[model samples]
Target chain A: MCVLAEEGYTGTADVKAFLAEHHGLALSDVDGHLYHHLNEEAIRHLFRVSSSLDSMVLGEPQILGQVKDAYGYASEFKSIGAVLDKFFSKAFSVAKRVRTETKVASSAVSISYAGVELARKIFGDLKDKTVMLIGAGEMCELAARHLLNAGVKGIMVTNRTYERAVKLAEEFDGTAIRFEEMVSHLKTADIVISSTGSPHFILKRDDVEEVIRIRRNRPMFFVDMAVPRDIDPDINDIDNVYVYDIDDLNNVIETNLEERQKEAGRAEEIVVTEVAAFRRWLDAQQVTPTIVSLRRKFDEIREAEVAKAMSMLGTDDPKTRKVVEALASSILNKVLHAPVTALKNDGNGRDPMELVAVVRELFDLTDGGKDCE
Target chain B: MQTLLLKSTTATYLVGALLYLYFIVTLKERGARLGRMFLLIGVVMHLFGFGMRFAEAGHTPITNLFESLSFFALVIVGAFLATELRYNLRVLGAFVAPLAFLFSLLSAFQKSELQSLNPALNSSWLPVHVIVLFIAYAFFAVQFAAGIMYLMQERQLKGKHLGAIFKRLPSLDVLDDINYRCLTIGFPLLTIGIITGSVWAQDAWGTYWSWDPKETASLATWLVYAALLHGRLTVGWRGRKAAIVAIVGFLLVVFTFLGINLLPAGKHTYASIAR
Candidate 1:
C-alpha cells in the first residue's frame, strides 16, 4: 500500500493511531508493516510494485492493472498533484518495459491457472461447460473462480457442511447441491475441481464411468487439489474422463517458477536502469524553482533601473523608453544564461542543488534571513 | 469445354488440398480460408462440367465410372463445405479436402468420353438409386474424417500428450457430434438407395434380391452403419468407440462403392453396365 501525499505530512503515523483507537488494535497487533519512501525511493518502490517484482507471486500481471485502477480513482478524486501524476505515469511505462523485456508473466505459475489451461485443452471452449466444486476449501474456491473467469456456463458447489456449500454458492452465484447427491450431479459437470478432507476417494473410476454414460461420453476434466486425493487416479483410465492431482499442478507450477526466477533477474535490471533515468528527471525538477526565482530577481532590478533612467531623462518619447527597456532586459537575460543552463543540465554527474544554492547566494535571491540555509 | 472444366476442377482440388494440408502443418487460418475458396471454385466448375456432360450424354452422367467418381468428389466436397459452415470446423479441411482431391484425381484418370446409357439402366430409378447412394457415401466420408480427428484427439488426451496437433484438432465432443449427425443423415439415404435399387432390380431383372458382389457389399456396409447408429442412440456409444465404428463403416462404404466395382462377378461393373 503506497500513499502519495504532501511533503512533511506524516499520514502513516496518523493511520496507525487511528487503527489503534477505532479498532482497539495496536499497529503491531495485526503483524502490520509499513514503509515510507521519500522522493527517489518512492519512484523505485512504485516501479517494483506495479511490475509485480515485489508480489508474493513474482511477475503476476494483475498488480499493474490494479495499480492503474487505483491511480485512476485517485486522479478522479483530485488527490494527486502534478508531481504524483508525472511519477505514476512514469511508473506505468517502467512497468510496461519490464513486462515486455522479460519473460516473467508468460506462463501460468498458480495451481488454479494451470487447471484452467488443462481444461481448455480438453473442452475447447468453457462457455457452455459446467464446473462442480466438491468441497469448500480455499484452493477449490480459487480454482472455481479461475474457471468462472474462463467462461464456464455455471458452477455447482457441494460441501459436507450444507451451510458452507450455500455460502460458497452464493459467493459465486451458483447452485448449492447436497453432498450426498453430488454423484448424481456429476453428469452435468464438464469439469470437476475437488478438494475435500475425506480420507478416501470421493470419486472413483466406477463412479465416473457411470457419470460419463449419463453425459453421453462428453469429456470431463477433474482437478484434484487435495492432500490424500479426493479423486481416484484410476478415473483417468476411463474414456473421456481426466484427473489431474495436486502433484501434477505442482509440477507445472514448479517449472513455471523456475522460468520466472530467471526472468525476474532480468526484470530487476530494467527497474534499476529506469530508476536512474527517473532520478535525473527528479534532479532537474529540484533546480527549477531556483532558476525561476533567479530570473525574476534580475528582471526586478532591470525594471527599477529602466524606470529610474526614464524618469531622470524626462523622456516623453515612447519609442526612446521602449529601446531603453529592451536593452536592460537583454542584459538581464544574458547575465542569467550560464547559471540557469548549469542548473537545468542535471545529468552531467554534478550536484544541481549546490549550483542552485550558489546562484541564489550570488544574486541574493533568497529571503533576508528565513531561507538562508 | 466440359473436359477442360473437369481437368481444371481436378487441378483446383489439388491446390485446395495442398492449402488445407499447409494449414494443418502451420496452424494458420489464412491457409484454411484460401483452401475453402479454392474448394468452392472447384465445386462450381465441377457442377458446370457435370451439367454440360448431362446435355451431351442425353441422360444422367453417372452411367460410367469417370462420371460417377467425379460426381462423388463433388458431393464429398459439398458435404464438407456444409459441415464447415455449420460447425466452424476449419481444421477439418486438412483431413477432408485431400479425400475429395483423391477422388477427383481418380476420375480425371478414367476414360471420360461420353457413352450412351445402358438399356438396362434406362429406367427413372437409375438416377434416384445411384445419386442417393453417392450422397450417402459423401456424408459418410465426412463422418470418417471427423472420426479420425476424434481418435487422434482422444489419443492425445488419453496419452497425456498435449502437443501442437492436440491444439489443432477439434474437441472430442464436437467430432462425436459430427459423427452422429452424419450417421443420422447418411443411414436413411443409404436405406432409401438400397430399397430403390431392389425395386429397380425387380423391374429390370425380375428379381428383387440377388447376391451380386456389389449388392452384397453394400448390404454389409449398411449393416455396419445400422449397428453404429443403433449403438449411439441406445447405449450412448460415443467418443473413441463411436469414432472407431464410424471409421470402419466408412471403409466398408469405400469398398462397396469402389473395390467391388473392380471385381468381375458384379453385374454393376462399369464395363458391364456402361457397355
Candidate 2:
C-alpha cells in the first residue's frame, strides 16, 4: 500500500528507470493482476497522449501504437497490477479514440509518404515513373513502398552494402544496382528517393546536373529523406530537377499538420470525456473498502450481542433463546441496511471524496481501531 | 467595443512576450509557468480583440495590410498556442513570443486605414490565397525556431556541454523530426498558396506568370524549401547543415512576405508596407 510519485521523466530510459526504482516494479513484474491495474495515467501523461508527449511531430499517429506495444509487453510480463491494468486499457481506448476523432492524427502525414506525394504532384501519374531508391535505409524502404503502391513502373535500389540493397530490392521487386551506377540510373529515374546514412553527399551536384542534362529537363522529382542527405544541396539549382530535401517538405507537413490539428481537438475532447469517466470509476472504487469495513463491523456487533442475549435466555428456554437470536439478527440487518445504501449512493455525489470522509468519520473507522470491540 | 478589445489583447500579448523573455533568461521553472499564464491570457484577450475587429469591420479582418497583418500575427499566435498546448514546448515561447509581439506591435503601429476592397481583391480567391500563404508562413516561422534549437542542441552534443539550455531543448533527433515535419506540412501549403495566388492574379491582371518581385521571391522561397526537403529526404541532409538550411529558408519566407513587398518594382506594390 506504499504510494510514491515523482516529477515526470522526459526520456524513455529515464521513465523505465523511475518506474523500476519507485514501485520496485521491473518490466518483469507485470503479472496479469498487476497488468489489470496498470498505472495508465502515469503512462499516458509520460508517453504524451494526455500531455501530447507522443506528439513530437505534433499529431503524427505512429507513437501511440508504439506506446501500446510497450504496454502490451509490460502486461505480458505481469508487472502491472489492478491499477495499471485498468489505466492502460483506458489509455489504449483513448489513443484509439483520438486517432478516430481527431483531425490531429489525420493532418500530419509521414515524411516518407510526403516524398511520394510530392513526386506525384510533379508527375501526374506515377504508373509510368521509374523510381530510383538510393541507400537502402528505412526511409528508402518507406518511400519505395509508397512509390510501388502508387503503381510506379520500376524501382532501382542502390546501397553501399550490396547485400542489403539486394535484400531490399528483392522485397520490393526492384532491381539492385551497384552504388557506383547511381548516377547512371538517375538519368532514367522519374523519381528518386535518396536515404543513405552517409556522412557526406552521395549524389554530388555535378553528378545530378550531368544526369539532368542527359535527361533533357523532362522533370525529375528527387526526395531526399536522409540525414546528411544523400543528394547534393546544389542539385536544386539544375533546371526541371524538382528536389525536395527534409526542410523543403515543411510546406506539405504544415498543411497536413493543420488538418491533423483540427482532428486533435476532437480527440482531446474525447480524452477529457474519458478522463472524467475514469475518475468516477476511481471514486466508486473508494467506497468498496469502506463498505467492506462497515459490513464487517456490523456483523461483529451482531454476533457479540446475540451471544450475550442467548446466554441470558438459554437457561429459561432453548426455544426462547432461538427466537431471541433470530430477532437480534433481523434487527442487525435492518440497522445496517440504510448505511450500506447511503454508502452506495454516496458514490454518485459530485465530490465523492467528501462523502467518503463523512462515512469514514461517522463509522469511526480508524485504520487500527476495532468498532465492535 | 471590438477595437478596444483588440487593442487590449495586443497589450496583453506584449506583456506575455516580456514574461516569456524573463522565463528564458532566468531559466526558472516557475518563470515558465508564469510565462504560460501570460500567454494564455494574451491569447484569450487576442481572441476577444479579433472578435471585436470582426464585429466592427463587418468582414474577415483581412482586407487591408493593417488588418491582414494583424490577422497574420493572430494566426501565428494561435499556431504557437496550439503547438505549446500539444507539445508542452514552453521553451519555444522565448523565441516565438518575441516574433508574435513584434508582429502585433507592427500591426498596432500601422495606420488602420479601412480602405474599400479593391475590385481586383474583391474576388473570393483573395482570402483563400492569403489565408493559405499566411498559415504557411506561420509554419515556416516555427521551423525557424526549431532550426535554432537544433543548432544549439548539436553544438551542445558535439561540445559535450549539456547545460540547462541543452537539457531544456529537445533531443537532436526530435528537433530534426520537428523540422522535417514542419517542412513537410508547410511546403504543400505554400504550393497551394502560390497556385491559388497565381489563379487569383490571372483573374485580376490577365496574366499568371508575371514574375513580379513578390512572385519571384515567393518562388525563390519555395525553391529553397523544396531544395531543403529534397536534401533531407533524398540527399540525407540533417543536423546542423539541415538546420542552417531551414533557418535560411525561413529568412527567404520572411523576405518574400516582408522584404519583397517593400521593393518598388512589383505588381504586389499595392500590398507593400512602405506605401
Candidate 3:
C-alpha cells in the first residue's frame, strides 16, 4: 500500500527509503511536468481544498470545516511533523481569511435562499409579514422553511387537497386555509410564496384584483416557484401586486453565484499571497540550526583558550589579564566575521541553505538547534 | 420663560431633523437613535412650555398663532412617537421626524406673545376640536411620509437596483401598513374634530354650517380622507393609489391650515386657528 500522505508526509529521503525497504513500496518517480502540475503549480492545494475550490460544487462551505477536522485528526495522531505543522496552520489561516475578507459564503447559493433574498428586498423587514404557500411540495416546503428562517410573522398554506395543506401547515406550525378562500386570505398575506405541481394556473389576475380590493391595495408579493406558475403573470398589473416566476428567482440565484465567484477570486489571491509568505519564511529558516551550532562551537573554543591563558597569567595583575582577554576575544570575533557574513548573505535573495551546508561541512557543525518551532 | 422654552424646543427638533436627514443620506442606522433622542427631548420641552403657558393663561394656551402652531408641531411629534412605539420601526422616525422639526422651526418664528381666548371661542369644546384636529393633521403628516417612502421603494424594486435607501426604509407592505394605520386613526379623529368644530361654531355664531373658506376647506379635507378610507376598505384601493391619496390629503390639510386665509370669503383665517 503506497499511502502517499500528501498532507502530513514531509517527503524526507530517509522516510521514503525506510517505507520502500520495510513496506515493499516502489518509489515511482513523477515526471518533471507532472510534479510541476501537482505541487509547484498548485502549492496552495491545502487552501483550495479547505475553501472547497477542489470540490465539484464551487464555493461549498462544508469542506473547510471538514478540512479542519482532518487536520485536527492528523494532529491527534502525532502524524503531521514540524514541516506539515507550519503548512496546515497556513492553510487554516488562508481558509479563514477567504471566509471573512470575501463574500464567498455570504450570499445565497440555492433557489430557496434566492426566494428569501427577493422577499427581503421587497419587504425590508419580514418579521411582521405573512407568507402564504399556495401548494405544498418539496420546493414549496423548502421555501417555507427559508421564509421561517427569515422571521416571517406567520405562514398560511392552501392546496387543492385540504388534508395536504393541513399536513404541510402542521409541520411548519402554520394555519391551513382552504384553496378557495385563498382570495380572502390574500388580504392578510404580505407575501404569497407558491410552488404547486399543477397543469394550469391556480390564481388569475381577476382573483388578485379581488384580493387587492379586499386588502385596500396594500402591496402583495407573489413568488411562483413552480414551472407552471401557480399565480397569473398579469396579476403584476394590479396596483400593489408584484409577481416573480421561477425563472426570475433562478436569475437572482445566478447573479448571486456570479458574485460568489468574484469573491472566490479574491480568496484565491489571499491564498497565493499567504503561500508565498509561508514559503519565504520557510526558506529563510532552513539554515538557522547549522548557523546557531556553528556560532556555539566558535564561542566555546574562544572561551576555553581565554580561561586557560588567564589562569597561567594568574590573579596578580587583574587589569592586565582583563586586557589580554579583551584582545583575545576581539581577534576571535575578527576571525569569525568573514565566515558569518558569507553565511548570512547569499546574493540576490538566493536561499542561504547552500552557504549553510558548505559552512557546516567546513566547521563540522551539527544540527543542534532547529530555529523553527 | 415661555419664549425660552419654545426656542429650546425648536433647537432640539432642528437637531433631530438634521440627524434624521443625515441617516437618510448616509444610511447609518445609529442616526435614527440620536434623532429619536433629540425629538423626545424636544417633545418634553415643548409640553413643559405648553404647561407653563397654560398655567399662566388659565386656558389651553392655543389662543395665538405662536401658541397654536407650536402646539401643532408638538402634537405631530407626539403622534409619531406613539406610532414608533407601536411599530418599533426605527426607520419611520428618519422619514417623519424632519417634518416635526421643520414645523417647530416655523413655530419658533411664530409670534410668542400670550393672548387670552376670545369669549366666542371659549366653549368647553375648544380643546376637543383644536387638539383632535391638530392630532389628525400630525397623523396625516406621518401618512404622507410613509406614502413617499412607498413610492421610493416601488421605484427601486421596479428598477431592480434595491439601493441602500430601499433597504433602509421599510418595505412597501410596511409603508402601506403605516399609511393604513395612520389613516384609520386619523380619519375618525378628523371626523370627530370636524363635528366638534361645527358644534362650537353653532354655539358661537348661531349656525351649524357656514360657507367660510376655512370651513369649506376643512370639509374638503374631510371628504378626501373619507373617500380614501372608503376606497381602502371597500375596494382594496391601496399601495401606490393609497399612497397618492395620502399625499394629496396631506396637501389639502396644509392648505386648510395655511392657504384658507388667502380666500376673500374666509371667515376663519390661519390666525383663527388660535381662536
Candidate 4:
C-alpha cells in the first residue's frame, strides 16, 4: 500500500494517472485510493514500516527481514535508481538501529516461539534433533511447525488412534509410533512435545530417567502443551531433562510480551530521530545537483576570463600562464564558496528548494535548457 | 635471542588471550581474527625460540622444567590453532588463549638457563618420548577447557537460566563432540606415548617397566583416558558425565606432567631434584 517515488511534486500527477490506467480505474477513484505523501513523509512512512512500528504486532522482527529481501530483489533487478537505493539502505540501517538500541525483537512474544526459544537455549542448534508429539492437538501441531521451521531434523507423531497419528506424521514427513510404543521410541527424540487428550501424565520421572541413562545423559527438552499436563513435573528434576508445561510456557511468553511492550516505546523514539535525520539527508540530496551545476558555471566563467586576460597580456611563458590559471581558479572558488555554503546549510532550518531555486535564478543555471529535474 | 623471542611470545600470548576474552564477551569477529593473528605470531616465535634453545643447549631442550613447560605451552597453542582451524570454533579461543597465557607465564618464572642433560635422558629417545607425551597433554588441555564449557552450559540449561552467559556458551552437543574428538586423538597418542616411554625406559634403565611416581602416574592417566574412550565408544557415555570425566582425566594428566616432579620420587624429576 506504500509507494516510495523519487523526484519533486511534478511527477505525482503522472504516477496517479499511470496507476489509474494500469488498473483500469477512474481517475477520481484512483486519486481517492492513492493517498500521496511528499519526500519527507514517504521516507518517514517507509522507516516506520521497515522498523515494524506500523505493524499490528508492534515489534515483530520478520517485517524488517522481509523489507530487506524486497530491497535486495529491487537491487538485483536494477529497478531502483540512486535515490531509492540511498533511501532503502538508510531505512534498513534505521530498522537495525531500532532493533539493537531497543529490546523490541529480543523477547519471545508468541507461545510457540517461546517453546522454540527455550529449545534453543537447551539444545543450541536444533538441526539434528528430533521432536516427538504425543497427540494431534492443534496447539501441539503449531508448536511442532515452529520447531520444524527452526530446523529440527525430524518429527514423530503418536496418538491413541493409529490412523490419526499416521496422518499427522505424514504432514510432517515424520514417523508414526503407536501410542503404546511412544515411550519406547522416546530415546531417539531430543525434544518431546506432548499434547494429548489424556487426563493424566503419560510420562513420569522414572521413565525419563531410564531413557536418559540409555541415551547416556544427552539433554532432552519436553514441552507439555496439554491441559492435563502430559509430562510429569518431577521429570524436570532429572539431570539433563527439562519439562515445561503449558502454564510455564505461557508465563515465559507473558513476561516477554510485557518486556517488548516497554521496549516498543523506546523503539518509537529511535524511529523519530532517524526519520528526521533521513529527511535532512534527503534535503541535502536536493541541493547536490544544484551545487554541481553551480560549480560548473563558475568554472566556465573562470576559464573564459582567464583566457581573455592571458591573451591581452600576451604571456607566451608557460610559467606565467600556469600562475594566472591557478589564480583564476582560486578566485572563482572564493567567489562560489558563500552561495554553496548557503545552499548546503538549507537542510538545517530553511526549505532547501527555496535556496536551490534562488541560486539557479541568480546564476541563470536553467539557461542551459534542462527542462526538468 | 631465544630467551628474548620466548619473552615476546609470552607478551603476545597475553595480548591474544585478552583479545579472545573480549571477543567472547562482545561476540565480535574482528577480535577473534586479531587474537588468532597474535596466536599465530606467538607460535612462530616460540618455534624459533625452540630451535635456538635446542642449538644452544645441544639437546632437544626439554630436559628441564623451564624447557618442558615452555614446550608444553607451545604445543597447546599449536593444537588449539589446528582445532580452531578445523572446527571454526572462534568462541573457544576465550577458554584456550588464557590457559596458554597462564602456561607461558608460569614458564617465564622458571629458570630459563640451559641445564646439563640427565645421563638417563641423554639419548635420542628424550625428544620422541617427551614430545609425544607433551602433545597428548596438549590435546587433553583443550578437552579440559571444552569440558568446563560444557558443564557451564549444561548447568545453565538444567537450571533454565538462559542468561547472557548461557547464550554465549556453545551447545552441549558441540562441546561434547569436541570432548570426544580430543579424547579419541589424545588417548591413542597417550597409548603411543606410554609405549615409547617404556621403550626408552628399557634402553636407559634395562627394564621395560618402572614403578617410579611419574611412570606410575602416567600409566594411571593413560588408563583413565582408556576407560573414558571405552565408555564413549561402547555405551554412548557423553554430555555431563563425559565432560566431568574429561575434566578429571586432565587433572590426572596435570599431576603426571608436573605434580609428580614435586614429590621428589623418580628419575623423571630432572628439573626439581637433579637441577
Expressed as tens digits, the lDDT of each residue in B120-161 for candidate 3 is 767788788889999999999999988998898877665444
What is the per-residue lDDT of model 3 for residues A1-373, given as tens digits with 9 covering 90 to 100?
A: 1222432233445455666567465654322112222343444777677776666656788887887777788889876555456667777777788877777776667778767876776676789989899887777788889899989999999998999999988998999999888878888998888887888888888888877766655577888888777788888777667777877667666766777787778888887877677665455435555557777887898889878887887765878777877987799789887877766665125335545545666887644323322
lDDT of 2 at B195: 98
Q: Can you tell me which runs of candidate 4 are displaced by over 4 Å? A: A1-45, A53-59, A65-86, A96-109, A117-128, A216-218, A247-277, A285-373, B273-275
In candidate 2 chain B, where is summed lDDT lowest over 10 consecutive residues?
B155-164
Superposed model 3: Cα runs more than 4 Å off: A1-110, A120-145, A148-220, A225-232, A250-373, B56-58, B115-119, B122-124, B158-161, B270-275
Q: Rank the models by TM-score, top first.
A: 4, 1, 3, 2
What is the Å distance of residue B250 in model 3 from its true position? 1.7
Better of 1 and 3 by DockQ: 3
* lDDT of candidate model 3 versus the reference: 0.76
Q: What's the lDDT for residue A327 in model 4?
A: 96
Query: Could you estimate the TM-score for every candidate?
Result: 0.69, 0.44, 0.63, 0.80
Candidate 1, true inter-chain contacts retained: 0.44
Each model's DockQ?
0.30, 0.02, 0.32, 0.30
Classified by CAPRI criteria, candidate 4 counts as: acceptable
lDDT of 4 by residue, B88-200 (tens): 88888999889989888888888887778778788988888888888899999999999999888877666654556665787677788899999988988898889988998
C-alpha lDDT values of all predictions: 0.84, 0.70, 0.76, 0.83
| Chain A: TM-score in each model | 0.69, 0.51, 0.65, 0.69
